[model samples]
Target: MQYLPLFVKLTDKAVLIVGGGSVALRKAGTLLSAGARLTVVAPDFATEFLQWQQQGKAELIQGYFQPALLDGKLLVIAATDNDLVNAQVYDAASARNMLVNTVDDQPKCGFIFPSIIDRSPIVIAISSFGTAPVLARRLREKLEALLPQHLGPLAELVGRFRDNVKAKITGFAARRQFWETVFNSDVVRDVQANRLPQAEQKLTALLAEPQSLAGEVYIVGTGPGDPELLTLKALQLMQQADVVVYDYLVSPEIMELVRRDAERLCVGKKAGAHSVAQQDTNQLLIDLALSGKKVCRLKGGDPFIFGRGGEEIQALLPHNIAFQVVPGVTAAAGCAAYAGIPLTHRDYAQSVQFVTGHCRPDGSEPDWHSMSRTNQTLVIYMGLMKAAHIQQQLISAGRSSAVPVAIIENGTRREQRIITGTLSQLADLVTQHDVSSPALLVIGEVVSLQQDLHWFGQRAQAAVFAQPLTHIA
Candidate 1:
């Protein structure tokens, strides 16, 4: 914090630009955007400066800049080509204790222009204290990409409702919470989507409320491996999450999408190790929601599958807590898609089944006969340890040894790997490939289509069939 940041109200304020070159023109443009009453003092004026002067948009004094020229201006800028003249201008402004900027000269200036991302009411200013302009500009570019263009409109909406919100909610905490809810609600989202009438309707409903609404929990599925696979509702829930309890399997990229200010609690449970028990996690959500905090129980895959979402939901049900579930691209689907193996195909497979490899300690396998039928795909989750047993059981149940099997490791991740082989040799292939945990095993005739359908693996290769690539931004 080399300099205290501030947004000066320059409207109707007198500002002087003591040069008529490109540098001076840039400063004049910035001041005009700020609604400053600008005066350009120079011996000679540029063509654009003369045009502005003729239009009376700005006043131009066709004379050399002197110390006396700095008399009563609210702000001044010395952007002249002459270094000596800029030094004199700096001295004159310093004597009068006025705010002045000497272009490119930090030591002689009262203020420096920041590399700003202008969203008007939602302006973001980045500065390197005149140390690195290029770095500051690069940082501004990154911020520009992260911030939505409709933020300006969103800010204007807030400005319009501020007074009403203050008058409607009496308690400080309640008032603060009201605004938080408004920001996280569908009102702002609808506005961003260019649905103004819908946004206004939502605002009206909020205004009609007699009291602040109660907070609730959202069970969000952060899709396996890829952040982009998240649902729009899931993204919104994450943005509004006051506290997020995440599992170890949630990728860092997905977690980064969460609000930076939100509290993140690691309650991940490994195969045999538990950091926070299931009961404790359920209790945490209940406590947070009761305290009026938006809680998000972020899981790796779809909550209803192998995830313990049912138990958590049951716990909340007893406590009368309100919660919503946001579905994600489950690991089975993600691995299958990224590996170029469809779970179902008309000629080879007609149905798809998802099953966990681990059964209860009673040592009974889950209906192996039904699972080994032809024209069906079997996706085994957390089944790396029992690959040999699973393969033998399926064979014993009359399934062909020639059935295609594909193991996808870290599917959808940058380091994702896929190994394809026959069902009889899948255990040996898995051993040779050293497939790790967090992998999915897909067994069906669909695996044979990998050679032609493996689009994800060939992203770097040029296509023989020409098609225009769409730029996301």
Candidate 2:
């Protein structure tokens, strides 16, 4: 190591900063957060520095730098833009045997700041010693997503019980084992779910005796076709799950992320296909959870939005099963964004309506009269099958046949296809392009923006019908 990594205590200590611009402001903020009393000497300061001074966090001395300014200072930072002035500060501090840092000058820096992931009380610092700052920042970003937000609170909670745990558990090995069990148990789940009281009670019970195995179900949404769009909690649960129950709507790429050894069950709920019935699927989840297996019920898009997740959860109610819901980017939002079709724009649409093309068992229809209003974007999921009926009904309800529409096939996936036309040509466009399942129907004036704002896919592939769609009387 070129330089030793040390986290020093700066509480109420004096630090001299020889610059008052943006660079000085940045270093001052970090120092103040560490409880350092700052003395900043510079020709001029940023607006924020004045605010900090008013807040009694810093002492600003406006003037050119002199060696006397470093008097009685424990640490020094040269943050001025002028190279000569920065070198002067560094030389003065080095002569006085003080720890000093010259911004952007690695050789002159006695110390350097690292990229910080502040899960407070659980701080992770990544440093390249100024050689690879960008790479270090990227790594920090990755860790930020992986680390749960409840870690700080969990650490504090566990810290408070350490004395009690040491007292009860006889040996070091036993205590270690007990802690391992606590972490692997639903205590982490309870903490993550913000059920602190339940977690505390469970912890107390565990310290008293060994805990019996208990299982939990996580209804995780994998998002529309893009595995990258999966929530952090969803990914964590899928990796930790003992068994994964998934639907055909889940993309193959997403299924690849599940724990490799996990038992997989595909309860097909595709359009017009019933490989496994809904009731059987619900019973399967209930049975798997009862057998003490952490079950991840993975659904594509949001499970609650037209995914029949509500019904499945209602089934688990009588059984008194523990479950968590992780929402994903829905198809309507993801598809419309990737296709460059904004769901709502002030000039085109002021509101958006999401409806299912799949009809209910009771043979009911959506309120087309309300949905047919102008200046509103209509996004239909699984509407490919009933495109003809949708067109006729919407047109009869007063939606113009010439209203713009786009069929997003395999939306957000690599093989994604976008086909555009008018409302009258919706059924024809589907037939002509052979649009399949996993496709979304985007209708309204926003569909016109697809040509100009279309970003994720090739615009050439999206054939906009040149002729106006003929109205059906």
Candidate 3:
């Protein structure tokens, strides 16, 4: 709070810079863009400054420091390389009660340039008071990625409708509410999709007929177990949700990211333990949406990939409830990558297959013969319970019992564990290590690369099962 933040109108206002190097050139660019009348004083100037002079965008005075140069200027910058000269400019400006900034010198600066996020009409300025300039810049970068590019155009559209909305809407609360609805409605989507005409029409219709509180369902994939792996759209929907229906597969770290005030409903499912049935969960989503709540059905891994997201959305379809599906990095891909096991390698593996251990009554069982092929990787999700059967079937189907295998537990998480061995001891390894749910089984020549490529977290000692090959089941 050393300096109060303000957005000043510098259009056509006089400004002075006391340098001719790259730093000065950078400051000049910002000032010129703001329509400031720039006058730079330095004995020698860069070539770009001379170009600006020829274009009449800047006045370059070829002389040393003089107090007379500060006259009639709205703002001053001491950007010179010489400390004594910059101090002279600062003293002169301060003595005349004018604002001054001495570049890279915090104490001497009366005003400082903040890291800017320019969404044009919607500009955001972040400053660390010059103490942590790099940190402030890094924060700006993160904000830039999070802030959508459509914001500037969206702001412009809202401004155009401001007067009309004010005239039509009765009270302050009502007007604010209407604006909120407009922002959340298809107008923003239309703007993002570059359908400006449709967006305008939507806004007009919204004003013509007062908007009702509608509901939406966001079927979001939390991405394996790593919270950072969530898609931007998934994170957005999670925060906006009034209700989050999550399962046990979602990690605690990821669950911490949900909106603080959002209501949490656990319809979690684990092997042999179903907290809420599939049909009941579908009915629950329908009831919640029918009551006009923004529901985020949080799932682990890609919702469409064995997450039963299709069933839930299909149920919503008949009821005409609006919904969106956001895909995430499924366990097969995420687990393999973090464990440093490439699913496909021309020298080792040429193809990959993803399968789930648990299947519904109507679901087809995995084709063990095709899965037992050489020079390919097979990733099994929720297969810990049937590891014995898997090992026996694959071995009986002519696959080598000595083939390298990896059981990745809690993949991509901080406590992620990987146990490697040959296919002969798949069940024994699981029992010995007590591998829990949410683990992935990777069986292939690529798994041999784990000892060479495992990069994240700690890994257990590689056990190449000394016991002779025997089908447990």
The lDDT values for all models are 0.83, 0.86, 0.88
Candidate 3 lDDT by residue in tens digits, 276-333: 9999999999999888788999999999988999999999999999999999999898
Question: What's each prediction's TM-score?
Answer: 0.69, 0.58, 0.61
| lDDT (tens digit, per residue) of candidate 1 on 238-352 | 9877789999878888899998888999997765567898889988888888887788889987888888888888888877888998888899987677666778999989999
The parts of candidate 1 lying over 4 Å away from their true place are 1-31, 35-46, 51-119, 123-157, 160-176, 180-213, 361-363, 460-473
Best to worst by lDDT, what's the order? 3, 2, 1
Report the number of the highest-lDDT candidate: 3
Residue 3 of candidate 2: its Cα lDDT? 82
Tell me how far the alpha carbon of residue 163 in candidate 1 is from the true structure, in angstroms, after superposition. 7.1
**Stretches > 4 Å off in candidate 3:** 1-137, 141-181, 184-205, 359-365, 455-473
> Which residues of candidate 2, in runs, are more than 4 Å off?
1-181, 184-208, 456-473
| Each prediction's number of clashing residue pairs | 0, 0, 0
Deviation of model 2 at 127, angstroms = 21
| Candidate achieving higher TM-score, 2 or 3 | 3
In model 3, pairs of residues that clash are: none
